[model samples]
Target: MESVGITIRLFGAFRKFGNGSEIEISVRCGTNLKELRVLLSQYLRENDPKFSETLVVDSAIANDTKILTNDFCIEKSCTLAILPPVCGG
Candidate 1:
């Protein structure tokens, strides 16, 4: 591990990424949400190769119940919830 870690939470159809509701991942200090996404993409490409293209498939990133932006540097380790896209009949 390089620095502190963060938990990447998955919901809805995004559960395939972690094979469950949540998964813990490590990231280097100063990593932003966008960079974290890149790390996640790599992780998926390595672990869940099939779900690589479906990561949330269009989702929102949240931290402590608040939405996080690309520039939001993840200085503190915490849980990030990824809410997948909604679908209806």
Candidate 2:
């Protein structure tokens, strides 16, 4: 998995993996963030049935240092942060 080298940081209540606030995931190089969301959704739904919705919609992804669209292209191994939707009145 080290060869893939994609680090994901979970924020809010997204850390379902039970390993602090960060985790390392593997994905094919050049995979877009949207595609990554689908991959993550599949895993989450299988492990935690409650998370049926894909991350593409349920959360925002911070690519490197900026909040980008799901279609943002991931060129190399980098750190991504998952932020649950902002809800407040």
Candidate 3:
């Protein structure tokens, strides 16, 4: 299976994954947000001992324009942002 590299900009708690704010992840072609989330969560768990599964479940994935639904399929390599749930009062 062919795969593409996707660059995801980390936000909130996700920034703790590495020294940089962005990380490149490779996914099989035609992967969607739901699948990507699982892959990312696994990657995080492997890379960071403090990673939590709920973070990926609660986060939102957005392209240059808007937040994408889990069913949205990514066909090409691109830069996207993962915005973790935010709370402000």
Candidate 4:
């Protein structure tokens, strides 16, 4: 299976992992945002027992330009940001 390299920029609660900013990972060529979320969740659980998969699921995936929907397919190498939910008044 062909794969592509992707960089995930951490935000909010997810910033606590690795270097506290970004993470690089490989995913299948046609992997969509929703599938990527599951892959990320698995990665976190394996890397850190305390990592919360729920956070990953609730996070928004965005590229350098804009936020992508769950069905958006990643076709090439790129940088994506994980924007976790935030609550403020």
Candidate 5:
């Protein structure tokens, strides 16, 4: 079976998703950003429900930029950065 690896960088309130700094997650080749978000949500929910609740409450995934699968193809490397909504005066 083929595997895909990605380094997810969490920013702002989203940093609570994983321990310490960034998180490295492995997914099957061909996984899209939407799927990745779901997987990430599961990991966060297991590790910290407070972060998970925040993610859900704030609709974090919905606001994320679409991340293409490497070359926009399945079976390729990809990176994702999660950030919370920002507002300015």
Candidate 6:
């Protein structure tokens, strides 16, 4: 299987779901962001339930200005920003 490197950066409350900083995950080339979430849940479930829930509900995995790969294919060496819903002004 062709593989690509993905760096997931979690912000705000979502950060608690990960091991701090960024996580480098290997994904099959053409994997979608939704698929990426499933992969993350496998790892995040061990640490925080809230992270999994938030990832399902509030986060959007995007590539720069365009929100490609929400269900589209992911490219090699792409960076997905895990943005959770923000509260407060």
Best-matching candidate per TM-score: 3
Q: Model 1, stretches more than 4 Å misplaced?
A: 54-57
Clashes of 6: 0
Point out where model 5 deviates above 4 Å. 53-74
> Per the 3 Å backbone cut-off, how many clashing residue pairs does candidate 3 have?
0
- Regions of model 2 farther than 4 Å from truth: 1-3, 54-56, 87-89
- After superposition of all CA atoms, the RMSD between model 3 and the true structure is 1.3
Model 3, position 80: C-alpha lDDT score: 92
**What lDDT score belongs to each candidate, Candidate 1 first?**
0.76, 0.74, 0.89, 0.90, 0.62, 0.71
- Model 5 worst lDDT run, 10 consecutive residues: 55-64
What TM-score would each prediction reach against the true structure?
0.80, 0.77, 0.91, 0.90, 0.66, 0.76
Candidate 4 per-residue lDDT over residues 1-89, each given as its tens digit: 79999999988888887699999999999999989999999888888998878888788999888989999999999899999997868
Please write out the lDDT profile of model 6 over residues 1-89, one tens digit for every residue.
Answer: 89988888777766665577667788899887678778877767766654446555567776667555467778678787777666768
Better of 1 and 4 by lDDT: 4
Candidate 5 collision pairs: 30-75
lDDT of 2 at 26: 78
| Error of model 6, residue 28, in angstroms | 0.7
Q: RMSD per prediction, one decimal?
A: 2.5, 2.9, 1.3, 1.4, 4.5, 2.3
lDDT of 3 by residue, 1-89 (tens): 88999999988788877666899989999998999999998899999778789988889999889989999988999999999888879
The numbered model that scores best in lDDT is 4
lDDT, model 6, position 80: 74
lDDT of 3: 0.89
